[model samples]
Target: MSEWVDVHFQALETCGKRARTAANMLTVEDVFQDSSAKQPADAAQASMFGDLSHSGALAGKVNDVWTALKEELGTGRSRLQGVEKAIDQVETNLRKATRAATV
Candidate 1:
């Protein structure tokens, strides 16, 4: 005989909400503009490279990395939203099943 497994849909919902909240809080502007580390990053690049051409390259690379991070976060948020939708569908189906069974 197979044992019954309990699924905590509420906990899953809470997790989804927390993840979305975190993702929303870390917007591209917040990461780039509002960050305290921007000046330090520029200084470090300039100190290490020590030339105008290399400085430009390092700056471009840094910008590219930030852009990539932003894109990745957006993708993650979209995927989490999809998961939330799936969870809602599953909960709805389970409720319908329980109701039909009781009837």
Candidate 2:
């Protein structure tokens, strides 16, 4: 997990946020409109409304997943950096060993 990977993951998170916002806005806007006096609000109408509500909730959940994944990605990036540093150190040590052996 390099910085590039972390950045890409963050971009995905941003997309998730935008999607969530859009979903919520659609549902909230519909909520603001009166549901009419019809009982159960017609099966088709109810289903459509329900779908919007469900989508809004799903969007929220997706956002949550992205948030958690972002944190994990940060941890992964740090871990990878540490590994790279360690590898560099080992390479330096190996080079020094080779020079000493040559001498």
Candidate 3:
């Protein structure tokens, strides 16, 4: 049981720290850059596809997908904070259980 508690605490701490780091790293600008990245279609493909100049329907769809993805990534920061809070609660509960066991 003591070992179990130690393991859970360690896992949660690692998870929380990693989550926080990931949340910080995944910023809106990064997402936007990722979304906006473009490669010119090859000559044959461009001729086959037609109208290679404008951002067309497919580009708009890609933007929409990226917009949704970016919003989801934005939530990760709060989710990490929530995980840390839950870990604190679990630690408190474990301490209580330990005290009760000693009694």
Candidate 4:
């Protein structure tokens, strides 16, 4: 005889929804659009201070860091979406199996 396992479909659905919502909210544009660090660094690079070679190097470093952060956020969003999809699939499969067994 196999052991019976209880699965909470509603809770899984809720968790999937939450993960999707979180993933949607994790966009780079939304998070970094109004960043003070980016604005100042960009301004500094575009202004007279940019004439200095050292200023350009510093600006480059800042841009690199900014790009890395955006990439990380994108990666995180992708992972969250993947998890949400997997959860949805699991819920669907479980429900189908339960129905088939009852019939």
Candidate 5:
């Protein structure tokens, strides 16, 4: 019985890991689907997870999702900053253009 209990525990941990992954993916998907302009919050539960009622596991999954989203937002912001800088340079160069250059 004890051995079986350990096996069950391992199974639960695996389930938890998979659940976390699904929740994270759902979160990103929602971001794209719901509000294409803003990042979405993490998922705290799924159909199976709700049945298990493991609130801790649910919250943990949400945290994992949130962290992943935060990372993605950071990357996106970095890229946007680069593009903005490029645009600014182009505008400055255009404004500074001489009549001779334009002709």
Candidate 6:
């Protein structure tokens, strides 16, 4: 049972790491996407530049999404930390219980 509990905590740790990595990736993606600007290839196309207000708004929306994801990732990390503490307590209790049974 203790071994199984250890395995579960390992899985949780991996999940937490993945969540942090994904959150970091989202930040990088937003930076790259924001820096992107569509340019016309020729004089005629330059004169026909389309309105980019919508693009700006869309980018804002995406940034908002990234912010939300980061918040969720933080929450997940906190939960994993709590679970790890709980697992330690459980293992301690199991040790005591085993000792009592042997006595």
Best by lDDT: 4
Stretches > 4 Å off in candidate 6? 1-51
- For 4-72, candidate 2 gives per-residue lDDT tens digits of 645655655565555444444443234346765332222222334465757656656666765565566
Q: What is the Cα-based TM-score of model 6? A: 0.47
Task: Kindly list the per-residue Cα lDDT of model 1 for residues 1-103, writing each as its tens digit.
Answer: 1123134556656766775676565565555675665523332355566656678678668778866886887887677677767767776676677668768
- Model 4 — which ten-residue stretch has the worst lDDT? 37-46
Name every residue pair that clashes in candidate 4: none
lDDT: which is higher, 1 or 6?
Answer: 1
Residue-level lDDT of model 5, residues 14-89, one tens digit each, is 6555544444444344557655475534455455356667767777787797888768865665555555556555
* lDDT pick, better of 3 and 4: 4
Better of 5 and 6 by TM-score: 6
Q: Encode model 4's per-residue lDDT on 2-101: one tens digit a residue.
A: 2343437778988999999999988866676667644333422524454766777786677788778779989999999999999999988987888888
Can you write out model 3's per-residue Cα lDDT over 1-103, one digit (the tens) per residue? 5788778878867876776677676666654465666533422232343676753655666667666766887788778767777877777787788789978
Which lDDT values do the candidates have, in the order given? 0.64, 0.52, 0.67, 0.77, 0.57, 0.57
**What is the lDDT for 97 in model 1?**
76
Tens digits of lDDT, candidate 6, 1-103: 3677667656656665665555454443443565665322332322233575566566556567766765775676566666556656665676677568768
Model 2 misses residue 20 by how many Å? 32
When summed lDDT is taken over every stretch of 10 residues in candidate 3, the lowest stretch is: 39-48
Report model 5's TM-score to 2 decimal places: 0.38
- Candidate 6, clashing residue pairs? none
What local lDDT does model 4 show for residue 35?
73
**How many residue pairs of model 2 clash at the backbone?**
0
Models, CA RMSD each: 5.8, 16.3, 7.0, 4.5, 23.7, 9.0
Which sections of candidate 2 miss by over 4 Å?
A: 1-60
> In order, how many clashes per candidate?
0, 0, 0, 0, 0, 0
